[model samples]
Target chain A: MRKGDELPPLEIPITRTLIVAGAIASRDYQDVHHDPELARQKGSPDIFMNILTTNGLVGRYITDHFGPRTVLRKVAIRLGAPNYPGDTMVLTGTIEALEDTSATVRIVGTNGIGNHVTGTVTFSMRDAE
Target chain B: MGDDPDTPPPRPDFYDPDDSAARPKPHGANDSTAPGPRDPDAVAARPQSGDTGGPAVRPLAGDTDHQTPRPHAHHPPDDLLTRLKAYEGHPAAVAGVGKDPVNLPMIRHWCEALGDANPVYTGPGAVAPPTMLQAWTMGGLTGHTGRSSAYDELLALLDESGCTSVVATDCEQEYLQPLRPGDRITFDTVIESVSDRKTTKLGTGHFVTTRTDVRVGETLVGTHRFRILKYAPAQRKKPPARPQRPRPVVNRDNAGFWEGVEQHRLLLQRCTSCATLRFPWLPGCAHCGGPDWDTVEASGEGTVHSYVVMHHPPFPAFDPPYAVVLVELAEGVRMISNVVGTPYDKVRIGMPVRLVFRTYDGDLTLPVFRAAAEEAAV
Candidate 1:
C-alpha cells in the first residue's frame, strides 16, 4: 500500500463487559478498569479502558485492514479520553510513510469525549496480494 | 504490553485471513500461545540488531525532540549500549507493595472475564489463580508504583538512543506457594540483563529483562521475569512463510473425527444400542457397553459456555490476548474451539455461534466457530 492510503474505519461499542474483559485479558487488574465503585474512589467516573487493551484494539484495527499476515513491529500510543462504558471508540488510520516493506501508520481512537488514543504504529505485511 | 509481538506472526484470532494466496506453514498456531514449556526457554532468546534500509529508525525521528543538540546523538553506539548494560543486576524495585491485597471480588471478576469455573478461586478456603502472581503488583494507570531510579534511568537511555517505542514481548512465572485471600503482597525487582542488540522480522532493538520476587512478608511465594523489547523498525525483509499449526493428535478412536473435519463437516458419535449422543469420539457409549456407533453431522449452532483469553507467551503463527472458547452445541454437547468474525473482547457468555471449518496456513483445517452476531464493525 502506498503512503497516504487511508484504512477503513472500525467502530467498537464500549460496554461494561468489554471493559472488564479487556482488563482481565491483559492481566491489568487495576480497580479502575473493572470496579465502578473503586473507580469512583480513584476519581474516575466509571470503569475505563486500560492502555494494554487500547494497544490490542489498535493492533486489531491494522490486522483487519492489512489481512492476517500483518506484523505489528511497534505500537507507541498515548491515551487522552477515558473509554467509559456505553461510549463507542472509532479507530481510523492513515499511512504516513512507506519504505520498502515497512509502513508507518498514524492511528487515532476517538470516543464521545475526545481522542481516546493517538499514536504511531510501524508494521509490515507479506505481499498481501 | 507483555504480549509477545514477535512470535510466528499470528492470524487475527477474531478475523479470519483470506487464504486464497496463503501458503501452508511450519509452526502450530495452537502451540504458539499455549503456556507450555516453550515459553520459559523463549524468555532467554534476546532480540538482535540490524542496520539496513533507510533512515526511518534514525534517533530523534520523532518531532517531539524540539530541544537543542542532545548528547546521545553524538555518542558512539557502543558507549550508549555499554551504559545501558551497566544497569544489569541493579534494583528495579525496593520493597514494593501491591496496591491491593489478594481479595475475592477481584478474583471473582478475573474468573468471570476468563470464564474459568475452577472451584479453587472462590468459596471458603479459596486461593487466587496462579497466573495472577504479577497482576496484584501492577501499577495500573498511575504507573511505576514501585519503580526504582535505576530501572527508570535505563529506560531513559534507551529512549534517548532513538529506541523510544516499546512493546512487551513475553513473561515467565513460577509459583512456589498458593496466594490466598487476605494475604498482603510484596515484591522486589532487579534489572536482569540487557541483551546485545538483536533483530527480528519486526525490527532491531535490545530485549530488557527484569526478575521479580513475590512474597508475603519474608516467605517467598513466586518468581517472575518480564521481557520488554525496546525497538524501532528498520529494513523491510520479505515476510517468512506462515508458520504451520501444531497437528492435532489423531489416534484410532479420534481419527474419524479428524477425517470428518478434513471434509468440512463436524462429526458426532451416536450410540447404536442406547441412542446416547457423545462428543470427542470415545470408543464406546457411556450408558451401554456397546462399541457400535454411527456418525451424525452436527448442525453447527452453539453458544459460548466458557472461554479464556490468552495474552502472554506468543508462539509462532498465533496471536495472544485472543479468545479461545468452549462452545455448547445445539446437539447437547460441548467442544473447545476458536472464534472468528468478532473482536475477542466482544465474545461473551451465551453468545450465539455457528460452526465453520477453517483452513489455516492453507493446510491445517479445524472445526472452529464464527461469531453469529451481525455487527457493522470488522
Candidate 2:
C-alpha cells in the first residue's frame, strides 16, 4: 500500500437481517438494530446499523485489501449518520501515510442519508508485503 | 465477492399500506386491508391498555416496549443526579471470574456468527478476536457470583425513583494483549462515572458507565468501558408494533451449520487427516493444517459450561434478562447457544442439558439447549 492509493469500495446492501445479525454477532443487544417499530418509536426511521457493525466492516475492508498477513494496530472511528435498512453503504479508503513497516489509512463509509462512518486505521503491513 | 449468493432478498417496507399481507397490523388498529393470520404470541406480548379510550397506556418504566413521548413531559431533578454521584467509583461487579478458560470453540462460534472469516481467529497460532474481550468475562447462566452490594443498591434506588428501565447505550473495548486458548480470565468493574440528568428520545435518565479491567492471572489483557441509560420509559402516541428477530447471515463457510439445523441434526466437523473435531465447520484444520474434513453427528447431550443473563439492552424479539448458555457437547466441543426449560437464574454450570431445534421465523431454525435436570433431581 502506498500513500494516496484508493482502496476498492465495498458496497453492502442493508437489510433487517444484516442489521440484527451484525448486532447480535458483535454481542450488542441494542433494540435499535433489530426492532424497526421500536426504533421508529425511538425517533429513527427504521432499524439502523450499530457502531460495532460499522467497525467490523471497516476492519474487513482494510484486511480484505491488505491480505491476512496485515495486523491491525488501531481502528479509531466515529459515527456520522445512522445506516438504515433498505439503504446501501459504500466504503472507500485511501492510504494517508506510508512507512517502512506500517501505514495509516483513512476511510469513509457513505449511505443514502450521508456518511455513516469516518476514521483512521493504523496497521502493520510488514508481513503483508 | 460483492454479491453474496446466500443472502435472502430484503423484506418489503413494514409501513407500506399496500403490503398488509406482509406484516400483521397492530392490535385494535384500523384494518382497511385483508386480515392475515395473526400470531397469538405477538398479541400476548402487547402491553395491555388500562383505558383504551383515554390514551394508550404507556408501558411500565422497564418494559421493553417502552417508548419515548413525542414531546418532553418530564425532566429529572438535577439533585437526583447529584445523589447518583455518590455511587460513582463504587464497585459494580467484583471478583468476577470466567467460568471457562479462553478457548478456541467459543472463538469459532463467535466468528461464525459474525460472518467473520478472518484467518487470524483460526489456524495453528490463532488468537481470540479482540472484540470478544467482554465474552471472556461473562458469568454464564448462574450470573456474576460476586456482584457488589453497592451496585445492587444503586439499581434498587433507581427503581424506587421510577427510573426502573435500563438500556445499554454503547461500549468501548481496548485490547492490550492477544488472548490465546487455555488462558484463564478474571475481571473487576467499578462505576467509572454517572452522567447528569439528560433527556433523549427514549426518555429521561442518567447514563451509568462502568470500566472493567480483564486480566489473565494478573496480566492485563484488555479494558472495557460499558455505558447504559437507566430511565423511565416514555409513553408513545400509539402502541408499537411487535418486532421481528433478524435472520442469521449464512455464508459459504458456515452454510453447513444452518443446513444441519434445518434437518434438526447438529453436525460437527472432524479433520479428515488428524481427526480433530470442531464445533464450527472450517475449510482447513487448525491443528493439522489439512484441507479436508468430514462430518460427525452430535449426540446433543451436554452440560452448561458457562452462561449469561442479558438483562440490559432490551430488544423487541428478546425479553430482557434471558439466559444464553455455552454448552459443552458430549462430542467434547463447546458451542454458544441458549438454554431453555428453566428460569434464567436457575441455569448453572455443570447443569445437564440436551439440544433442541427452535424455529424463530418462517424459515429460520437454530439449535438451542434445554436443562435436563428438573426439581433438583441430581
Model 2 residue B125 CA deviation (Å) reads 1.5
Model 2: per-residue Cα lDDT over A1-129, one tens digit each: 557888999898887777887776655666677876577556565788876677677777787788777676656555555678789999998877777777777777888877777666667753433
What digit string (tens of lDDT, one per residue) describes model 1 on residues A9-114?
Answer: 8898898897889787556766778877566444355788876567666766775677545655555555556789999999988887777878777777789987
Which segments of candidate 2 are over 4 A away from where they belong? A1-6, A19-55, A76-87, A92-120, A126-129, B1-76, B139-142, B155-170, B231-378
Q: List, residue by residue over B212-293, the lDDT tens digit for candidate 1.
A: 9999989998887776767554444435545567888889999999999999989999999988889988999988989999
True contacts kept of each: 0.06, 0.07
Per-candidate interface DockQ score: 0.04, 0.09
Model 1 has an lDDT value of: 0.68
lDDT tens digits by residue: candidate 2, B6-96: 2321211221122123222123321212111123332333324432231232222333233333221232343244345545665677778
**Highest-scoring model, TM-score:** 2
Error of 1 at B313 (Å): 30
| TM-scores for every predicted model | 0.37, 0.49
Chain B TM-score, all predictions listed = 0.44, 0.44
